[model samples]
Target chain A: MTARPKLVLENVSMTFQSDGKPFTALAPVDLEIPAGKFISLIGPSGCGKSTIFNIVAGLQPPSTGRVLIDGEDATGLIGRVGYMLQKDLLLPWRNVLDNVALGMEIRGVSMKEARARAMPLLERYGLGGFEYRYPGSLSGGMRQRAALLRTLLVDQDVVLLDEPFGALDAQTKSRMQEWLLQLFNDFGRTVVFVTHDVEEAVFLSDEIYVMASRPGRVIEKLPVDLPRPRDRAIVSTPRFVAMKKYCLDLLHMAEPADDLAA
Target chain B: MATKTTSLPPTRSLFTVLSLFGASDDKGRPIRKLPVRTLWSNWIIALVQLSILVTIVAGWELGATFGLIDKFFWSQPSAIFKTGVIFFTEGDAFTDIAFTFRSTLFGFFLGTTSGALLGMSFWWSRNYARIVQPYVICLESMPKLALAPLIIMVFGMGLASKVAIATALTLVVSTLTAWSGVQAVDRDQEKLFYSLGASRFQVFSKLIIPACIPWIISILRVNIGLALTGAIVGEFVSSQHGLGRTIIYAGQTYEIALVWVAVFVLSALSMVMYAAVAWLETVLRKGINQ
Candidate 1:
């Protein structure tokens, strides 16, 4: 039998109470992320993609529905899955090494052991000589890598990335995407990524979910047939272009008239 | 054109002076040459400061010599300096200094620790914080000096009274600022820790406390002055020996020079205390960040 999906969401929805009004941020939605697969949720602004992430991360409980990890109910339980946001969120008061080891430290690993474990990862990730440098002294790309290291150090199998590289410049972003892909390949972990960039989604995902806003729901689940160990050259391929175009069309149709006008 | 020509000579002289102070680039262009202003070296700044101080002292001495001002009331700088020397060399100034320093140190430590702890506790409990908010505001607004007699009455006329007043003065503001600091911790960071399965206490000790440290250090800097003021005020109300008591006794006997000497010593003491707090901030920050 096919391995039970690493993470499953059943009819999960979020309703935020704003100014005494019940506002539906996300409608009932179902998602299944298979083990050792990379899935991307691509949509326009206000698509409640981040809302879904917040739910899965257990930062907030879903107004309705359930979350399951390896078929076990984990509704509203925090610290069960790794979550990285758009911002690096590295503590400014911490150096690169300490920042990377923070999650493990919080998980009760002693500081000395955490640092020792982090050293090899730092060197492998090209952050070795700068391990003791403060986050402020690092470049944006380096900070994000450090943040990813922090997320990974805790040893969560399913990692949720919410536009983690959205703030990066184009060149740096491309390089980081390749680095992340290699890391993901090596780790063999389940990744659920959220991004508005179609090309990014097409480049990294094994499967892509096109979401619609205004009571957000997944409108389409498109399988990316791109080959393994994909790189920048893949973006130039006709199939890649077709996939990107397909996602763009769905996103365009998903946007509200007001958003189009602006 | 006429104004530019007239300004040229002075501007050139200023540049030359700045160049003399090593403000020139490799190619000999004056670095950041402001037309009318000359960059002063640390030595020059020190010299200018010393000159101003000397001028003030000379003016006071000359005024006293010429009878332009009443030396009995104002006390000439020379006589004040002589009294300060005597206090250091021949009098009980050392004992007074030691007593006041000890009281200030104790008060500073007690006030800082209590303020920081109370602030963190408030951060941990919203209900308790809300209940205590109004009372804290009221106490903070009430001039701490007004409670000096009561503090002295309760704690007695010794070092304990001085420390009590100092802690009282510092506690409110330090608690308020530190509480605000904890409140102002980045929402993302807090969420990050929570997502990592950090318990509420873990979130507090790992994230909230470390995040609020800069604020705590800043409050400590402010508390140093407040603590000193509290200690002196306590001594002023009732004390056997302290700089405050010395000043009071000198003033009562119209020993104006001795009073000036005490004032000088107090200012010096304040500077030393402020420097110590600043050094602590640097060391703590380095340790935490590293």
Candidate 2:
């Protein structure tokens, strides 16, 4: 916790034009995420939470400025970060085991080794018996678990999750949130997750960065002081409730004043 | 997963094959039982149909004895049966049937392979699609029968000309449908693979083409029929052998029975080809819906 930042974003800015005028999406923002910290970017729709992840993931080049990962420039840092999308994106034709081993497959890992490495992960996530079942047959929660396992199997230094459980049912989402927190604590992978859900960010993240619309800038950063190895009951705890309130206030500020003040 | 099925079940499954074929009756229910009005009250429709067919032949023979219709123009069923017997006995009719069957099968294979490959090529390259798609559609809309003479002129009155005509007729439709199938692949799935660091070639093979299998099978079924038509029409226009040639010869000699026999054999050939494609469609699509 006393070390330098693992990822540094210096004066990162992105501008998208609509109707022939330059509309700024992300303002020149500077931030630092310490290594092994679980960070969540929470914002209202169109606040560019996804843009931030995309920028960091190197899927999109920043309009200006640079992203540094592990002291290297972002351009040369691909495959160092594993990205999981909102959709499970599991290849439907492949079985559960293969889906979990996909990133390793892409990295030129041998089939035997990939399957062997994925075995413990699949078993740990309660998908051991379902190794041969296709993704189409798995429940949404199970698929997301497999997707997370896939990202983990890649052995990337940083993990970027973009609303990984946004498509799940409310009950399943709560269970998955707890599962993710437990998994993060056990593995201690540095996570930069993007979610619009204030509660989810509060419940799972070690630090929450709230973003605002119009200029997609970090308006507030709240340190989640909730205890580690969090459970379902943590959602109703006083600390979690206070953090959610802080996020709500930041989100209110992020919204255009005219839409909320009235 | 490899649980063996009893032969009895497979045999019973064929009884309901029409329902599996997606055919429904007027009441929107599957016609699992024989319909009353089809003139076949028997268990096996093909068998009952065959029996009724033979009774019609008997009636026609009796009618011919009583001079119901002119025998030369509308030949009796018995005479048709006799012509079949004669063809099998003294003539080279079996060879003609075999020739037609050979060419039809060859044409079907050529049409399917080239069509699939060309269609996949179009799918792989946008420029190819843009360049060849218009020409393909144009050629598809043209009557393939009209191309028979031109094909004969180009390749001579050989099996090559017949196969070429068949390929030209079937390939365009298959290519278009296959291209559509490839294009219709889910973008979400593609993005998933792309994010996983799959190259374009891997995505094309692992995601796009596998997703297009059912669509390709549908196109294959339709093209098989077209391929047969193209082959026979090509033969009718030029070749000295084949069932098509036999039909033309019979027509010239006013041998209506021989013409009917040739037509029946060709129809059966088309049905067998179609049935094989349909079976393949079942096998290919079985795991997809899951």
Candidate 3:
């Protein structure tokens, strides 16, 4: 537990100006993600879960405070983290192979080399025959898989996944969760995931950060004691069930306070 | 509209022929054999289209023969066809067509390329776009053909002036359309680019330009017609060559059949250009879009 944190959000906060008035979207907060941990941030809509992701991705800088990566102050700086959003956001025009090659190509790798590098990942994942298919023709689950593979190929140590499978159906979502667990381990990358489903958070995360809205802030941080290299079957375990129950209880408790003054 | 006028009656004749052969249609639910019906009717529709042309030409020919209409004014359809054949075979009609074609194509290429380039550059600076947008609207709202006299005066009533007029008509529309495409770009994709450490130039070249292709392709289709109109109008105003000038010459001499010949040639030229644009759109959009 004494391993130096991979990422730290020191007193991070956000306030937006709306209609000539001040609106605090996120209250001051400090969070540390230990190296190589699967962390989840679960909160209701507008709880600044996405705000934190935007700040961490450097798409938006926090109004105050800073972010640190490898103990280096990396506040308001982009390209340090691999970020995947809710929508797959695949270019409708590009086929799966080219889409997967985008991140490397942007970083000055020759397209031929980048494409050669991406080929094996496509084969290993479920997209073997779909390398030449356009995004519009792909099934939703397959598109998300392509998108996730694209992010993974970016090869950043820390990855931010915001509701990556939030749009999947129950059966597909379950299947994706199992697949993602495999990926998380095989890739050995630190991930900060944002999701609303408590069971999903409990299933995948090493630590879960529960957030409260109305001047959004972190309310609870629970460490999962479940053994490593988990599978979907573990969700039925009493320990997993209890952990999920505790997180759900925290979220519901935070909900009724939504009417409180900001 | 052609189908509505005379195409439907042929279906009755086909039904009569089929019924005579004991071939009955389900006409009951119309759910089955639906695609078969479309496939069957398409051929009939094509034949009917040919019949419609025959009917119009026969009517015009008969009218000219019997004096229901004046051959001097309407000109016999066969005479017009003969005149067209003669012009193409023995006269300089092909030269005229080539002149109009060159001016239209040149104007289209120059206007769309320059206009779309300027329009897309607006994405580089929000302040620049805000300042320039109103002027674009003003230019768009004003009738551009009115500038023909000035353009002709500047370029001198030659191929250059015709190209200038065509360019003037197409430029503003392409500017507005390309600018709108830039504005409507998906913010999520833009953010994704930024997240990938793409520089502003990379975002512009790789993302913005490719994403706006459909819009630009649409502009291509529209601008081709406008360019033709500009070139013809420029010729009408003043020109030594082109199909438009030939039409003016034929009209002044009251050579009605030659006027009809030039008009038909212009129509054929417009169709060829339109077909070309449609093909280009398909080819360009195939890679970037579904």
Please give the DockQ score of every candidate, comma-separated: 0.66, 0.24, 0.63
How far in Å is the alpha carbon of B61 misplaced in model 2?
Answer: 4.1
Candidate 3 Cα errors over 4 Å, as ranges? A257-262, B1-40
Writing each residue's lDDT as its tens digit, candidate 3 over A99-122 gives 999999898899999999999989
Q: Model 1 in CAPRI terms: which quality?
A: medium
Candidate 1, residue A15: lDDT: 94
Residue A82, model 1: Cα distance from true site in angstroms:
0.8
User: What's the true lDDT of residue B16 in model 2?
Assistant: 57
- When 2 and 3 are scored with TM-score, the better candidate is 3
lDDT of each: 0.90, 0.81, 0.91
Instruction: Summarize candidate 3's per-residue lDDT along B47-149 as a digit string, tens digits.
Output: 9999999999999999999999898899998899899899999988878999999999999999999889888999999999999999989989999888888
Instruction: Look at candidate 3 and tell me the lDDT of residue A193.
Output: 95
Q: Specify the poorest-scoring 10-residue window by lDDT in model 2 chain B.
A: B8-17
Assess every candidate by TM-score: 0.90, 0.85, 0.90
Residue pairs clashing in model 1 are none
**Residue B193 error for model 3, in Å?**
0.7
